[model samples]
Target: MSKRLKQLTKNADKNFNQMIIGVLIVAIGIFLWADKNYFFWPPQLRLLMNSEWSDIVFICLGICLLFTALTGNRSRKFQSILLILASAAVAMLLAEQVWHVLGAHKVEMIMAVILDAGLLTLLIRCAYKN
Candidate 1:
């Protein structure tokens, strides 16, 4: 490989994980912001009403993730815990979306049950992990 290319590759390798995490965080933040602002034309049903506090939670999580990424703290335990929490939040939100799209029925119930069970399993594993 060319010297310049090799150097670029090395730099990317060094920060790949952090870069990915940072990008995901920023992407999620943008998604949340867009949802709140109704960027999705015709707009799907709101998971939380405009008066709910969940928007603030999303904003805060996004900011924290971005900050962590910018600071290059890839191995922080706090970040891991935050991610776990976020995963649960995502699962719950997804269940709501499923309900919205599928309506109140068996399909929604099955999906939500599976999602919640998976989330619970993940939480248990994370808690017990050394």
Candidate 2:
């Protein structure tokens, strides 16, 4: 096999491993949040409208933005992550403040799920692509 192909193969493996580590770190952090509160710290489906969730969502959005800015080759991955973060921020804001079965909160919730799923898919793709 060509040297370039071998180098690429090795690099791809390293990227795959990094992605696995990233997934595990995120999963563990989320699990820790759940353990602490019996749910995510931000508390989805807020009926009382806690401002704390908004803060957490904002932080997540910021992190997504930072990742997108830092990783140019992983634009696809971070683009989806950014969408998810945006949806999360909107959903948390609406769910906590709006509080209705068929209100803005519902749309936020739907967008959150769609974007999150897309983000996961992008991450998976990026993991394999190197």
Best by TM-score: 1
Worst 10 residues of 1 by lDDT: 38-47
Instruction: For residues 5-119, write the lDDT of model 2, one tens digit per residue.
Output: 7765654454543334344334433443444332222346332243344445555554544444334326566556555555444444334323332444444445545544554
Per-model TM-score, in order, reads 0.48, 0.31
* Candidate 1 wrong stretches, greater than 4 Å: 1-50, 104-130
TM-score of the candidate numbered 1?
0.48
Q: After superposition, how far is residue 103 of candidate 2 from its true place, in Å?
A: 11
Q: Candidate 1 residues 33-105, lDDT tens each?
A: 5556422212344433332355556556656655554554456687676666665655655555455446644
- What TM-score would you give candidate 2 relative to the actual structure? 0.31
Model 2: residue 82 alpha-carbon error in angstroms: 3.1
